[model samples]
Target: MEVAVRVLPEGLEPIASIFEDLGTGGVLIEDPTLIARYKDEPGDTQVVSALISGQGDLPVVKGYLPVDERLPERLDNLKLLLDNLFLEQRPEISTSELPETNWATAWQAYYKPVAVGEKLVVKPSWEDYCSEDGRVVIELDPGMAFGSGTHATTTLCMQLLERHLKGGEVVIDVGTGSGILAAAAAKLGASKVMAVDNDPVAVRVARENMVLNNIQEVVKVFEGNLLQVVTGLADLIVANIIADVIINLTKDVPRVLVPGGKFIASGIIKDREKDVQRALKETGFTVLEVKREGEWAAIVSILGE
Candidate 1:
């Protein structure tokens, strides 16, 4: 069933709590800037209410449950919980028509080969991309998941990988969106590579890309958030997610690193670099280098002694 939630400005915190509590399919952030600025208490409680979409003449019911209950019951409680929260008033929503096609095929029209440093090139699977002068080619399809190596963050991360990754090292890619970084690690001769993402779709897509690259066995893909489900120490850990998630990850990334393990992070705006660096410092990582392209930045850090 499709469910749409309208959260007033003040209700955003509760909405975020609901997403975290219910493990919902996917969240479409209407106001990402506002959500990014929200501050949360350590033990904040949340309530979730599920209401049927496009159901006419049916009275909606809302229900409340503690965070530990099964997801189905939490979803069942949506209508009741929403009724109390909104007092039975439906929020106004606008819909519009746009040109549509199979996005996978449509995306191919705009996809082009991108050069990431002197040694590496990223090409779409539908295109025939040949590297001149013996450069490394990473063939990928930018499906519904993000990270196709065209973003400034991905390019910066790849440049860092080109420089720092030594053969036979263990590497971990946190938030491995399309398994791009993990595949690059395999190509660079990393002895072991593990890629993890919270989205199962992302994990599936990453696995498919790994197979396309003929490195499916070399790069293992796992479905989970951050580094929680990942085991073993890594010589290199690369995370290309938002600034806030990167900061949260820094608190635990060092623990999964060998003594001299290196950490590479991107997907941060230039303005947020200092804050992310501070968070990394608190987690025993010393910033070794910073690379900038346009409005984005990537940081390389080594575990502190």
Candidate 2:
């Protein structure tokens, strides 16, 4: 079965991330007002919908936002969050059952090849994408993890990676969803890459993607939180996790980076950029640059030699 989730525009990004993490095949976004509004204008209302199958996926799915009787309470809590923020009007949250079909092939239509930076292209495994000369392609089957290259946060990380990588650097990717960053690093000429995720499902999915991209020899996927399982120092570390997790990871990042190593951190809301920057600064990191896309921000920091 599938659950169709509807929330206002402001709530779409986070909610979509949540669904993606939950292992849903894909989330379809619909905004009816986009056509009428100007190109830069954002639609006020939007729907974020996802498909989940069987009793196995139901328990895990309901833990976040239930499709059962407790759904009203979930909706109420979400509205309360919006109310406390006082940014915009509260979003309307609703859910309904969707007809089941062959989800694998059905979802392929929703994802396409996305170009990141100057050299890298993120293509779904089912899509046939012929890269231009001098471009590197990373094929992915994100499944439930994140990093399909569509999210602004992921794109910002990829852009920073493209700009900073000088070939033959050792790289670590914390909270490496879909192993996209790890695979990209390997394809971009990183000598060694380590991809870490606490979730077992994500670890498996990431490993599969590494093989799909033909970077298995250079990139290794591990199941662990942040840098807990990481050993040797890396020349570059990239993370596309939430702002709060980035703050926590900052404490450990310095210990795992070589002198003059760089960090590319994203998945931050524009409002929380300072909070993340402050954490990095307190940990003796020099904030090199801050990049923004819409309401999201990515920060590049370096450890002193």
lDDT: which candidate is best?
2
Q: Write the per-residue lDDT of candidate 2 for residues 241-265, one digit (tens) a residue.
A: 9999999999999899997999999
- The TM-score that candidate 1 achieves is 0.68
lDDT computed for candidate 2 = 0.79
lDDT of 1 by residue, 20-96 (tens): 55655445544433332333423222311111123232221222233333645755555455455553345322223
Q: After superposition, how far is residue 70 of candidate 1 from its true place, in Å?
A: 22
RMSD of each: 11.6, 10.5
**Residue 252 lDDT in model 1?**
92
Candidate 1, position 175, lDDT:
93
For model 1 the local lDDT of residue 145 reads 76
Whole-model lDDT, model 1: 0.77
